[model samples]
Target chain A: MAEQDLTSSSILIAQAQTDTGNSEAQQPGNAAGTNDAVEEQVVQEANDAAQGITVVVEGSEVVAADPAVELHAETQGAYTEQEKSVFPPFDSSTFGPQLFWLALTFGVLYLLMSKIALPRIGEILEVRRDRIEGDLAEAERLRQKTDQAIEAFEAELAEARAKSHGIADETRAKIKSEMDAKRRDVEADLAKQVATAEARILKTKTDALANVDQIAAETAVAVVGKLAGKVSIKDARVAVSDVVKG
Target chain B: MAGTDPISQFKVKTLFSFGTIGADENGANGVDLVFTNSALFMVLTVGLIATYLILSTRGRGLVPSRLQLVSEMSYEFIANMVRSSAGTEGMKFFPLVFSLFSFILIANMWGMFPYFFAVTSQIIITAALALLVMAVVIIYGVWKNGFGFLKLFVPSGIPLPILFIVVPIEVLSFLSRPLSLSLRLFGNILAGHIVLKVFAGFIVSLSALGALGMFGSILPFVMAVALTGLEFLVSALQAFVFAILTCIYLNDAIHPGH
Candidate 1:
């Protein structure tokens, strides 16, 4: 409503200014037209001046000018002494020197109100609104910054976790491969030792058998004389060799 | 001193009877402390305005009651007055202008009551109102436009020789505002009241009588009634004029050269 009023008033003022401008432009050319208007005003004033002279009309002393003269006269000066007594002048001074004081008093009061009271009210309201707006904007900005930081931290944390999991898996695979190679080498050495031991056992048995036969033959030659003793040695050597083979 | 007679006499002297308060040092006890007659009416006028405004505004609603409508109407009326004369730039002064209108309207209507005195009848009151309005124009104009407001006193597009003659006339007219504004209201209201009083006293003095005499009495009574209504219009109008002029003055203050 207030805005509308301001707009309407501005429109009216603009319209008025335009009208005034147009009239001003036309004034110079229309100066002759006002000459008749001036003459008419003079005639009217002359008639009014002549109104003071009275002439009898009907039963009353009406002025020659018009009935308005008679009406004016009767209103101003018609009352006689008896009529005057009926009406008394009100002694209230409406137009005395009091006007100056009134103007002075009003001037001071208006000045105080316009300068002091109004400005204070306006200033307080403006400051409050500004403070509220500033606080809101600051809070919103802070909230946005916090949200961005949280998002960035979460993204980095996820990347770190993935990298650690990859490293752990690679270390486990390397350890498993080395353990397999060591196991193979140990198994091969143990197999070689078993084979060599078998070979040695075979050679010792063969050699013992050959030595026992030769010794048994010599003992037999000698034992021809000694009979059963040499035969018993060769039998003993054969028994020992069969035992070793088993 | 004649005691009560002195007090009563004092009431007649000073503007709105400050003499009574001033004369308290001499004598007359405290009888003059309480307001009476015209002063009493002045108080009544203020009360009437206050009461009406309060009652009209109470229980305010979006749709509005009849009383609220009147209150809003008064606000809108003065608001338009300021906006029209002062433009959008002048709307900041709405509250002040509206208050002036309401106060004057109440004062004028209060006079119609049998025992009330019209504040506008007092030159001091009218002049003070005018001064307040004029001061707002000058002060706010200068405040907003700075030294530019001085251009109001010096019109544009004049021959160098004419500048001296035209500028003084414009300055004098500018200075005459408070005088013209205060006097117009003071004279109109004062004259109307005096006419009413004289005619009313006549009605009292003349015994209700023969056909013509009775008919003659009716004329003053009718005139008085009509004048009462006109006085109401004048009261609102004078306040409006005062505010509008304030806006115009403010406009000059705002846009000095134009």
Candidate 2:
């Protein structure tokens, strides 16, 4: 219901606005018959409008000038004369007060500005300047610190890399030497075992040769006994041994 | 007839009277220390300057607020103007310069309102201000430079025969400083306001004639608006000119030479 009332009120205001607009529009059309009449009417209304503003300024002046109620006959003529003087700026009656107030207000302004606003504003500007310079100095210091930190970090990293390389090289050298020594020792042991096996084979061959000569002599003796009975076995062995030697 | 009269606006209507002192020779009643519309606007002008400047610097933020920015801008603007014109030694006069600048600037702006009184429009007011400026200049110059401040009138480089022509001119000009300063301001403000009123009155008068009059009033209305803009510029510019002149005059006090 409130929304409806608001909308209805707005519509009424809009209609009233149009109505005034139409009335203004209708004036020239209604006065179209007589040009001189229209001109006179315009002049008359313009004069009234001009008077309206004058009265407003005058009314405010009257209200402001005095709350004292006295419209005496003597003051009325003086008022007209005062109003007729036209150029109030040149009027000497106002000079004394204007000068007085100018001094007072201008004095107040100078005091307020000089003693209060100027110094405080100056201080604010000074404080801001100091703060900016300090902040910039602080930022420079922090940047330098960051640069130093980066340098130290890089230095540490390079040192750690160098140390790891040295350790790796030392370990590699030590392991290579140990492996060389073990290879030489294993080769020497294998050579010693091969020499002993070769010596034992040669001895076995010589011993077998001696046993072959005796067996030949015994075979030869057995052959002779079968041929010439048991006589001259020693002599048959001697002959077989001499033939085998040849 | 008096209402439409542009000159009527400058009338010093007393707002609050402290009673009459005595009747003058002209049979006019003399009022005792009555506060007029002129005084009201003057007080209002001072109040505005104080309120704005004080509030602007109140926060004192590292990152300045918009108000603070404007406040500081005005501060630095006057400060730089003083420094440039008067040199570093002239910084002592910063408060005086700032006050005059803000006071005039604000007063002129307040008068831009249709019904508001323009304090500077009065000859006596401007003359008083000009006298105040000259007072500061004379006092400070004499105090600082002693008898040597007379060098301001006599050029050091000019030949003796030419000095005859130049010295009197310089003296006359020096004597006329207050007059020129006061008249310059008063005339500018007084003329600008009168013109603005006349143009505005044209609009009001024309627009009262109905539709055809409304269309015709447009020309004056536009002209008035344009004049208003120019007046605003003049207001600010005159303030700057006044302050700078103050600085230049103060510079002579600091270093009284060509």
Candidate 3:
């Protein structure tokens, strides 16, 4: 679709060029008049050709003005009239132009593609690939760092737990030894107090026994004075001492 | 002229007649270097290709737009085709293969449109392109491989007696490659366009007949439409065939034996 439009436009441009050439050639006298007439005829022919109508070349002036335009019109007319087998594309006459343009265009395109377009595309592809690979490498590196961090955290946690357990054991052992020493001191103080109390009690008991012997001797002397009891004071003391001994 | 005369469409009309350039007298039977519709369309093909490649890649974004995606896909498609057919070494010729593919594809597609000249339909153009490919193959083949390139015709493992019979056939076949390659593309596109024109002519002629002709014209019109669809496929397929064949020939140039 685009090709046809471009071709027609190119044909128009070619027609305009021929028209200008004719105008330039006839520029001396009656130039404006011939130009106006030639332009009108060319426009009509172009329109007719576009409409697929056979354009009738009316005036000799238009034909005289531009022989090339007339030739183009006649050629187009003859083209439709002649059998397609005799077409110039098949004819050797047009192959030169066709091949010439083909080479020219193909050469330009090859240079453009190889030199400019393909390399740019290749660079884009290469850049995208490199970016992706770099991102993946970075992600892998970060993942490794995270793994190392986790490993370190676990190691530190284990160390802290072991340290806390040792501290607890040491505190428990120190408290247990201090309590045992305190209980031993209290027991020794109680034993010493009991020994001193026993000694004092023994002395009190002996003194009380001597006082009883004296009281018995005095009572025996009073009785002897009063009767026969006085002579027996020493005997009474000895009897009390014997009874105490027994 | 009959409306169904399909060959008429192939006629080349001179658009601008510049009598020969640089030469005073008419040389070579007055073969003036007049620009014709063929040149115009060829130029258009180049323009379109440039537009497609350049405009599509203008952004050069990492994440492609639709047009960029299409351009990239076409690039990768031809790239892979060259790689697979010709191997990694063939990638060096990717530009040639890609240009040929794009030009032919766009030309064939352009021909499908009404009033457009299919450049590939012309024998001269296809022949020129095919000859260029053959030239590259021969030049590069000989330059790169020296005499080893001749081994492409002579297989290794053939018995001595059978070698005499096989070598000439191999040479003949190798020589015919360019002809076959050019003709294959030209013939397919030419025949396809002719068929389409004939069918379209049917509708015109039938409808001109009368009421009954008008009803009959529908059949030809429908057939033309269907054929247009098929021709679209043929256009792309022929371009692919041409390009892949070029790659294969280049591969022979690179690795000649097997």
Candidate 4:
């Protein structure tokens, strides 16, 4: 209301200024129509500026012709009593509606979230989780299979190593037994040859002894004629026998 | 002229009357339930949340899209908070906590837009929300723990002498939950926005001054820009704080012990 009054007052001032200018133009010695037109133009500009202020700011009013200082003062005073009551947030008049709408909207949000929105999101998450878990389980199974295959390969390797060691041992034993049998047969042949030579030497010694006794007997008969040679041969044989027995 | 007055931004103008209940000497001053910009934004907030949550997961891919991933992360973030603070049994309140979290976070984000109404900025609105949370805590606390809920005030392992001092403080803090919860959000938003408007208004006023003033306006212009970024952070942070605080209070209701 104050702003409208101020705007109307400014329009009145503009009209009064135009009227004075028009009356002055009509007086003698005053500039004619041109002067009135210039005055009207200035007044029109002022009217426009004031109307502009009214349009820009509603409650706080100042005369359009006021200097910057007064304009600042008016601007400072803009927070009037009406502004206090009309402050949107604290305005008690809006509370009922704000509350009503808050409840209605928030309630709708809750119902939508709880019933539809969130569950759907959760189901998506659950599906993703299940997928990841399944993939992990499959991976674990493959790793286990790989481990078992590796274990079997190692077992085979160990068995082959043990079999090769057994074969080497058997070959070594067979070679050693064959060499031992060949050495035993050669030793037995040498022993038999030596015994036979010894038996022949003993037989030759006995025959030589018998021949000495007969030669001694024949020599004694011849020696009886040739002196004591025969008697000496028989005596020599007996002496030899007695000496051998002794 | 009141554009410089930051408080003007928060003023609730009635777009239309829903219905009037207590019609009095002032024909409209009755329980004139009007849908307002605030109300519209509230609906928008709810609508945005619902649409995103519902539509993003429509694909239900084993590998989620970016939108679906964000929704899942938000869900898990709130879910973890509730679970960690209140434990597994408190998962019972998941929907409620989820709803509150989404409502606050989305509403705060909407407020970040220039010329958009911040639902969280309203004292009545924040107060009502705080009261609602407290109501849940108190009612659920009492119902779940019976008289044992009072044990939340009397922490265990305190000496008898100290409890005399401590118990009352606990109860006082408990009683002030709604006040603190509501004011924390309201004050932060109100102050942040007011500061932003003030600085923004400064740029306009200063630029009106000649060339040198234009250079001077640069400072406020930068300040306003920086403040906008901070406001975005604050919007998200306030929502996070509100959610975590709700979980903590729910925990008190769940266990009702120190």
Error of 3 at A103 (Å): 0.6
lDDT of 4 by residue, B1-258 (tens): 255777888876557655657666545334556678899999999999999888988888788889888888998998899899989988888988888878888888888888888888899999999999999999999998899999999999999999999999998999999999999999999899889999999988888898999999999999999999999899889988988899999999999978
In candidate 4, the residue pairs with backbone N, CA or C atoms under 3 Å apart (3 or more residues apart, or in different chains) clash, namely: A88-B11, A88-B12, A220-A230
RMSD of each: 23.6, 21.3, 18.4, 12.3
Provide DockQ values for all models, in the order shown: 0.02, 0.31, 0.28, 0.30
Candidate 3 lDDT, B54-158, residue by residue in tens: 888888898888988888888999999999999999999999999999999998988888888888888999999999999999999999999999999899999
- For model 3, the superposed segments whose C-alpha errors exceed 4 Å read A1-80, A83-89, A176-246, B22-30, B157-166
Q: Is candidate 2 or candidate 4 better by TM-score?
A: 4
Maximum-DockQ candidate: 2
Better of 1 and 3 by TM-score: 3
Tens digit of per-residue lDDT, candidate 4, span A1-246: 566667676776777686766667666476658666767776786677677656655534333323333232222211223335345667655566789899999999889988998888888888888989999999999999999999999999999898888888888888778877877777777777777777777677777777766666555556664774335555656755665568
Error of model 4, residue B39, in angstroms: 1.3
Q: How many residue-pair clashes does candidate 2 contain?
A: 0
Task: Tell me the docking grade of candidate 3.
Answer: acceptable
Q: Pick the candidate with the highest lDDT.
A: 3
Q: How should the candidates be ordered by DockQ, best one leading? A: 2, 4, 3, 1
Q: What is the Cα-based TM-score of model 1?
A: 0.46
DockQ, 0 to 1 scale, candidate 2: 0.31
The Cα error of candidate 1 at residue A74, in Å, is: 42
TM-score head-to-head 2 vs 3, winner: 3
Instruction: Please say which candidate is ahead in DockQ: 1 or 3.
Output: 3
Residue-level lDDT tens digits of model 1 in B1-258: 122121121122222333323234434322222223444444455455555655655554444688766655665676677777778877777657655665566667776665455667766677777887788778887887788888887778777899989888888998898899889887877777666666665565443666677767777778778877776777677766766776777677667885
